[model samples]
Target: MSSEIRQLEPKQLWNKFADLNAVPRPSKKEERVIKFMKDFGVGLGLETIEDEVGNVIIKKPATLGMEDRKTIVMQSHLDMVHQKNNDTVFDFDTQGIDMYVDGDWVRANGTTLGADNGLGVATIMAILECTDIVHPAIEALFTIDEETGMTGAMGLKGGLLNGEILLNLDTEEDDEIGVGCAGGIDVTAIRSYDQEETPESKIGYKIVVKGLQGGHSGMQIHEGLGNANKIMNRLLFDGFENFGLRISEIDGGSLRNAVPRESNAIVAIDAIQEEAFILEINDLANDIKTEYKTMEPDMVIEVSETETPDQIMDLGVQEGLTRAIYAALNGVYRMSADIPNLVETSNNIARVIVKDGHVKIGCLTRSSVETSKWDLANMLRATFELTGCEVEFGGDYPGWKPNMDSDILKVMVPLYKNLNNGETPHVAACHAGLECGILGTNYPEMDMISFGPNIKGAHSPDERAQISSAQKYWTYVLEILKNIPKK
Candidate 1:
C-alpha cells in the first residue's frame, strides 16, 4: 500500500480501501474479491451469506439499547469497470489496481482506481469492524457486476433482506444525495459484410484519435467531451468521400457505460493520393481539436503508414456502416422540464467493431421517464434499420422514482445539514443507473437514498476519489446511523 493513502484521515476507511487496492475485482470476474469479502465478514464473526448470484450480505447486530431501531441496509457494488490506457499493460483478471495518492485525491497508475463503489464498500467494512460507533442493526449488501449489467441487483430475490431502509453508497458526489436515477437499455446493431481484395495500387494507413477525456456516459454526458467513435466516423466519412478510402478494419471503445476516449481505423488509398489524404486528415484533426479545445485540449489525431491488409470491407457495406454511425445520436437529447440542469434522456454511441464478416455497433440510452426510454430505443432501432442492420436491445433496467416524502431522506437530509455546519446537501436525481431501482422492485416498502464520497471520472481510467471528502462522508453517514428512527 502507498504511504499517502495510509496517512489519510479516518484511518479505518482508508485502510480498508488500501486493502481493496490489492484485490482485482473487475465486473463479472469477482471470484477472488468475493472470497476476500466473505472471509472478511467471517473473520469479524458476523452472519454472512452469499446469494446464488454472488451478492454478499453481512449482518451485524445493533449497538446496546439500539436493537429496536429499524434495520438499515448499506449497499454498494463489489465490481469495478476495468479500464486502462492503451499503453498500460496490466490485465484485469490477474492484476490488482496500482493506486497512489495524487495530492488531495487517490488515483491509479494508467488504470481505473475502482473508487466508484470501493470506497463505499470499504466504509461499510470499517463500520462493521468498529466497536465505538453507535448504530442500529446493519446489513451490508455487496452486489456484483454492476458495471456491465445490473446482474446481481436483477437476480436478487425478494424477501432475501429484512431491512426497511437501504442506503446506496454509489452516487459520486459527496454533497448530493441521489433520490432517483434513469433506467437504461443497451442497443446493438450488426451487419454482415463481404470482403473484397485491396487494390494492388493502394497503400494502407492507420488513423487514430486519442487523449479525449472519456467519462461516465450518464454523469458526464453534458460535459461536452468528445466521443472517439463518433469522431472516427466523421473522419471516415470524409475520407470515403474525398480520397476513395477503403476500410480494412475499425475498432473503438470498450464499455457501453463509458464515453469512448480512443478510436482507430485502417484504410487503403491510392499511393498517389496518400500525401493529400494525410494532409486533409491533419487539417480535420486540427479543426476537431479547436472545436473541443476547452473540454479536450489534449486530444490527439494521427495518420500513419501501416501494413496493407489482403482484403477490405465491400464498398456498399463500408458506406452504409459509416453513414449509420455518423447519423446516430450520441449525446444529450433532452433535459428535464421539472428539474433544472438534469438530463432526462440521453444516448451514448459507446462502441464500434469490424470483424471477419460483420461490423457491430453498441449503444446505450438512458431516460428517467419510461416513455422516453423506449422512445430513444426505437429511434436508435430506426436509425440502424435504415442501413439494413439488425438491431437488438437487452439489459433493460427500470428507473427509481423519487419520493420527496421518503422516510430515510427525512432523517438523512436534516442530519447531513447539521453535520456540515448548516450547509444542506443537494437532493437530486441522477441520469445514470443505480441498483436502488432494481432493489426497490424487490423491496417496494424499503425507503432508499444514494450518496457517497466525491469520485470523479467513473467508468474511465481517469477515476479518482477525494481524500477529504471520504473522511467527511464517513463522519456524516455515522451520524445518520446513530440517529436512525426507532421502529
Candidate 2:
C-alpha cells in the first residue's frame, strides 16, 4: 500500500476518515463514493459486485489456513443523514464534509460528522485492504439510503449473501452489543383553510423561538431536549389568551427524527397591546429557558419587527392548528412497564411547517411492540380528525426483536469474553431502529449481532467518534473473522 493509503489503526482512522470526508456522499447521492469503493476493490483485484441500487458487496478470499472457515457478512449503510444548522451555508449535495481533529475526537464543521456510518465504511475499507489480518471468506456489504428509507436493505434477496452469520457494524457504543432495536413509523397531518385578509388596525409581529439544542428524536428523546416548535406553540397559546392575535404563519422544526431547533410564528397582534406583548413574550421565553436550563440553556424568544406581511391562515384554521399541536404528542408518552430501562412507546413532534396553503406536521412514533406503535399512530390520526384535517401515514419499518438465544451470540459470547480478558460485553436493545430487525424479517434464519466503536451526538452537527474505541472495535472484529468455525 502507498503512504497515501493511510493506515487505519484506531489512532490513524482520522486520516482515512479525512479521505472519505473529502467525498460528498449524502443519501441517494452516492455515485462518487460508490465508484471510489469500486475502484479501490478493482485495484486490489477483489471480487466486487456493485448492485443496481448502488449497494456494494466485496468478497475477500479466506487466508490459506482459514479457507475452510464459514463466511461472515459485514454489513453497514453507505449513505448518511445530511443535517446542518440554519446558519450553516454548506450544501450536502455539492460540498464534502469539513472535518477537524479535537484531541482523540474528530468532528465535522457545522454539519453531521457522518461518523455514524463513515467509521463502518472506513473499517471495511481497511479490512479488505489489509494483507496481514487473519480472516475466513468475508463479504463487506455496503447498503444505501439506510438513514432515510433503508431502500438498499429492503431490496436484498435471500441468496444474495453467502454467509449465514452477519455482523452489523452500526451500533454506537463500544462496550455494548445491540441485540435489538425499536421499530418506527412516520406520520404526517395536514390542515388547510382559506386565508383571511389582515384587519386594518391589527399589528403584525414575528414571534420567533430560537436557540434550542434539537437532537435525534430517538436517542435524545429521553434527554428532555426542548422542541422549538412545541415551545412556539406554547407562546401562541398564551398570547391568544391575553390578546387576540391571528396566526399569519407558523413554521418550525426539521427532520422527522430530530427535535425541532427553532420555530417562528407570524401573527397579527392588537396594535394597542403590541408593547406589552413583546415584553410578555420575552419574559415567557426567559422563564422557559430557566425551567429547562439544564436541557436548553440558550433558549430564547425574539419578537422582531417586520414589514406589512401577507395573510398566512384564517382565524379558524389557526385555532384548529394550535389546538391540534397542543394535543399532539411531544415527549416521552409511555415507558416500558416490563423492562427496567426500556422505553416501550414514545413520539416526537419532529417537524411543523406552513407551506403552499397547508399546515403540515411531521411526527415520528416508535415502539418495541407493534400494538403500541399502532396505538400511537391511531392517536395521531384521531387528533387530526378532531381538527377535521387529513392525515397520512407511511414509512413504517419493523423493530428488531432481541434474540437472547441467538445462535451466533451463543458461539461468540465466550470468544468475545476471552478476547477482552473475561470482561463480558454489555448486551442491550436500543430504542432506535436498526437494520437487524428489517433484515431479520427478510432473512428469518440469519443470525445477527451488532457492535461498533463509541460515537456521540449521532444525527446532529456535533457528532464525533472516539479514537481509541475505533482501534478496539477493529481488533475485535478481526478476531471474530479469524475464529469463524465451519458451518
| Candidate with best lDDT | 1
In model 1, which runs have C-alpha deviations exceeding 4 angstroms? none
RMSD of each: 0.9, 2.5
Candidate 1 scores a C-alpha RMSD against the true structure in Å of 0.9
The TM-scores, one per candidate, come to: 0.99, 0.94
Cα lDDT computed for each candidate against the true fold:
0.92, 0.81
- lDDT tens string, model 1, 50-133? 999999999999999899999999999999998899899999998888888888888999999999889999999999999999
Local lDDT at 94 for model 2: 84
| TM-score, cand. 2 vs. native | 0.94
Summed backbone clashes in each candidate are 0, 0
lDDT of 2 by residue, 391-423 (tens): 998878888888898776776677778878998
